[model samples]
Target: MADDTEANRERGIFIMIYLDYAAHTPVCDEVLKSFEEAARDFTGNPNSPHTPGVMAKKRLEEATENIAKILSAKKEEIIYTSGASESNNLAIKGIAKSYQRYGKHIITSFLEHASVTGPVAALKNEGYEVDFVNINKDGSVDLEHLKELLRDDTILVSIACVDSEIGAIQPIDKIYELVKTKPHCFFHVDATQAVGKIPVSFQNMDLMTLSGHKIYGITGIGVLLKKEQIMLEPLIHGGLSTTSFRSGTPALALCVSLESALAYTTGHLEEFYDKVREKNLLLRRALEKNKNIVINTPEDGSPFILNLSLKGVNTNALQAALDEKGICVATKSACCAVNTVSKPVYAMTKDKKLSLATLRISLSHMTTAEEIERFLDVFLEAIKG
Candidate 1:
């Protein structure tokens, strides 16, 4: 009876410790309030010509301007989309389709999220030549090889600002300088894992992708920042809307939520980052002493994510063990978690053993010191048992 009660306790009633912020974050209170208010007040279609529509349009424009200001971009540059996947698809495929006359070759890193990878692959199938940039053992982009890969015919170069698997922050500034050597080449960044958690600049970026859910906003909204000079072929075609590139009715509630989330995140970014950085350091210091664990995240990368490979411990089993104790972690991107294969870490390092044992522990400003402590205690016991 005592054992039964203990087992039930292990699997029940405990407050869950959510450590998967990179996968997606819960909508914060501020963003939720804005969404609720928008739903109640802005009920008209933004494109309609009636007074209610005009009011909705005004509010929508304000949200767009707010997001642009936070990112240091022009209001006209922001293109709203369903999420990062759509934004990535539009940016990659749109550029390839529109600029084929200038060039047919494109470049990207092997460490990109599947959203970026899938669109690039589709482009390859459509007869465009694609080049993948390799990463160093530490997961940083190989700048020398990238320099060699550039040519007069290279039309676009896409790289992730922050890699999701290993949390390696790419040197976008240096990459921008290199890609500029080819006058016709445009640069795009899949910044799903970078924005809000770290400082991002659009000075050198021709196109960049952002997702609202990743920043504690609604799940269905995303933003693509495109330079006014860059031309993109329309991915969706229908009735004319505010922009010709993507044709669809925009969700006003989602826009309001995304704008509010960004305002909250960027307004106190330094404070939020500093707190998470301290937690990251605490976790690293605690695990570094264990000879059986290998830490893969770069020391200078974003502090919100940590990657580890545990020797002699099955990663799938450990994840399950932690989940049973009301702690949530991940073995890969949430989108690819169920697959038995691990690609990103293995491709970056070519270490099969490390990849199979990989675990991703992501933090957020909402994470508490007590949660971290509890995680370490539960994790160590699971590994030992």
Candidate 2:
């Protein structure tokens, strides 16, 4: 542990046990290798007309095809972007802009990532009506409230497939059934946290967003999967690349890494999920042994995230203590940055103590049992102190 601490310190911040996979994952070695190889051989602009460019374009095409195969979607339906933020921006704003004439109202849940919320807020500023559905005490979106809000003027129904702060898995199938019954409304899912951690079928989903960095892939690349018949106005336009949806030379190397990572996760998902569940259960049981601590994550929530509240403990003090002991976790969505208050998801749960004193311990396939045990040791010591 000392040697690990030294190495981590040399790397910048020292956190021996990194349990914040929901925020972002370290790139897998295999994905890194593929990224390096692609960078070396496919450096040409994918949209250029030269031989090298043609080769790079082919690599991009292959990568898109591979990822589409994994998602069971058509290649043309996949649009590459810088990351999930861009994908969500394009999906929400593009749809809102394109379909504005048909309807000016859009419905979404309050627990969505800032990427989605920001766009919806911007749309509201521009005179579009945006209605947010309430979440249940367990942090799940209320589908009945959504159904009540649906109207002929509601052009889109957007929701996060998984609550990033609380780890509650939304019932997308049930939401889809409700939305599908409304012929005028299109369904979009921000599946950034759910993509690799949970099984997702795009069969009933019209639009889905995925982030590469969340699934051990290289950062700066993401995918927006759209149904074949769905159309949205282009977000960025200039070059002829990306079928005019997005313009500019595609990141061939990043695309390759993202595809490879997704394929690897899809193949080993069952084993990985089982291991993650075992580790999470171990940590949860150990943490619960302390009568003062409360488990906040739903029992049936995604296996990778554990949200906890330490009674009579200040979150900042606990966080500092954990950091000193070389444990890394977070208090809220990393997207919101450190030191920020809890998100709407926590607020909706109505457990004020848990909401404010919460800590999120997110896991990954690479997270080990030993790391989890070490975390509990440090956590208990911190709480006691």
Candidate 3:
């Protein structure tokens, strides 16, 4: 794929129109500038006690404060990590170990990303009882099922705020209300697909996960927002750092870029939402006309992602066909194993064949009408028998 893309660039004809924004976003110039500026200006370890070190620590603190202010959390509540995957792990595993004496039960749904599911699976192998909350036909968490699943022994309920593959928005507020009834239970939300695209409040969560690349910031930086009262077993326990929950040298540049990207995204969320809605609508109108295509994303799902399945058609072949036309998308989550059915789609549609043939076309505020039209043209051609 890399070689083909490079060859295409060398030929200097078609520039790829990317529609995989759910998996990753291109770092914007402004965010990249912030990263470069931070690297140059803060040339000392935040943990160091000297003059340059103090300056670096101050800058990183300011960045944390900025992000906390956006999340409606205190500065001390934010713990930086490698990315959302680590945050998910820390939340699931850390909470499992820290509070296991109270209870050893965990609840999650099939709609979660690989990162969330991976940790939960690991816990199950370690003698912790794990339960999966049923998802509704729309792919959102089934509240009644979740209610039945929660128990006094349920120490944690981890769920994604939004389904990555099909974009189903979970009712976080209601879920919080349910989780809080259990005194020992902690609610962890993977908001990696939610924060920059829509409005979310950390006030209702015990632990929350989000990453930079999803919002056009530099990759490899993310945060785990922990309520100040919670105690987490440290994921990385080697050195002194911002929070004892994870210990590592801060990626100061990545932190700065994350703050910049988040600030810009939250500030213009409405505008971004409206723009992506129109693009999603365009894709929906065009694709729904094709008898071979079945839209998997619910009507009320996030407008940034539009998932559809090609009936009786091999999605991998379709993806390759679109690639030939210089367009980019995903068969599922970018990290998902290739040639496998989309779990989220199957949860929503309950159709194995449709799930097997699913394709994800994620949009962004940067996506233009021209790109959508071109993609539809190529897509229609590819699906032609």
Candidate 4:
């Protein structure tokens, strides 16, 4: 019976109409090609001193330089990591560790990804005080409340440039203006959901995190851009890799793929945005026509992510029904989806029903209008069932 089931599963090819770009994107073909070439040709350890090693080191430097150019940041500011989660942890913990003597108070928004919230929570357990800013119904941070929370002993103010759950783009520029005026406060942004999807500059940020997988690059690769003057303790110790901030055998292929992905986005941003916006509008219209649906994501947010709530339908059951029909979407952040409840979304919305019924549908440049229509058709049917 098991063998029969296995053979049946093998015979059925699941065509995933993925709508979860906010969680992670399928690696782009151009990025995969670049990565494959690097993996096959640049296998030498970057830390070695021999000729192959020298070449590998040069390749890594070139990749870093390319990514930095696209981000408008210095090459030295970009530190490679496994992904944005690690980058967020390193940024928060490293800063907390390095500057603990200066202050013990930290501030962050409740809507931040668990990657940020987890680190802040850990720091709080270790005697550091943390203040969590509340978000408005549209999922925007309350800037006045944040300002009130800021104090002389506040050492860090961390926030997400884009809320992964509701896709609301925070006022990072406004927050930056407010925080930069404080000489002692450092600003960190988890830009995993913002980079590549929208315009981003490092000018106002003390530190920022980016995930390769979120931008159609290979997984297990991310970037942390830190201001040159900012002090951060090393997360890992050993031979020099990423200015000794993170130490490991660098994934050269992943880095090369990330650089290629960035290049691709830089060249096609306008075209990509236009197409995604059109598809998003189409999807929004389709969902809006369904009186059972309530749009949760902000209307003005990133065109790539759409969050919705369906009345009288369980989100998990709806997701399962959609999966059975060969459509792919998510109930929440992939990292936290397995949990029975959405902790992050609840922190922002404070409505259990909104959090439980919420489904995130994200788009990529490759997503088509046909796919959106098919998904809506399937979704409407599923809700009826």
Provide the overall lDDT of each model, using Cα atoms, as 2-decimal numbers.
0.89, 0.85, 0.91, 0.85
lDDT of 3 by residue, 1-385 (tens): 2336657777775588899999999998989999999999889999999999999999999999999998889999999998999999999999999999999999998889999999899999999999988888877888998999999999999999987899999999999999999989999999999998999999889999999999998789999999999999988899888888888898888999999999989999999999999999999998888888999888889999999999988989888877776789999998899888899888777888999999999999999999998888778877887
Model 4: lDDT of residue 202: 88
Residue-wise lDDT of candidate 4 within 1-385, one digit each (tens)? 1224334556874466889888878888999999999999986888889989889999989998989999999998988999999999999999999988879999998678888999899999999999988787777888899888888888899999987877889899999888876668899999998888788888989999998888888889999999998888877888766577888888889999999988887678888988999999998888888888888778888888898877778888888877766778999888774635565567666777767788899998899877887887778877886
Candidate 4: where are CA atoms >4 Å away? 1-10, 337-348
lDDT of 2 by residue, 230-324 (tens): 77887888877766688877888888999988987888999899999999899887888889888878889998898887788898778777776
| Candidate 1, lDDT over the whole model | 0.89
TM values, all candidates = 0.95, 0.94, 0.97, 0.94
- Superposition error at 111 for model 4 (Å): 1.3
Question: Counting only residues 3 or more apart in sequence or on different chains, how many pairs clash (N, Cα, C under 3 Å) in candidate 3?
Answer: 0
Cα deviation of 61, candidate 4, in Å:
1.4
Measured with C-alpha atoms, the lDDT of residue 12 in candidate 1 is: 71
Order the numbered candidates by TM-score, best leading: 3, 1, 4, 2
Report the number of the highest-lDDT candidate: 3
TM-score-better candidate, 2 vs 3: 3
The top-ranked prediction according to TM-score is 3
What shift in Å separates residue 123 of candidate 3 from its native position after superposition? 0.7
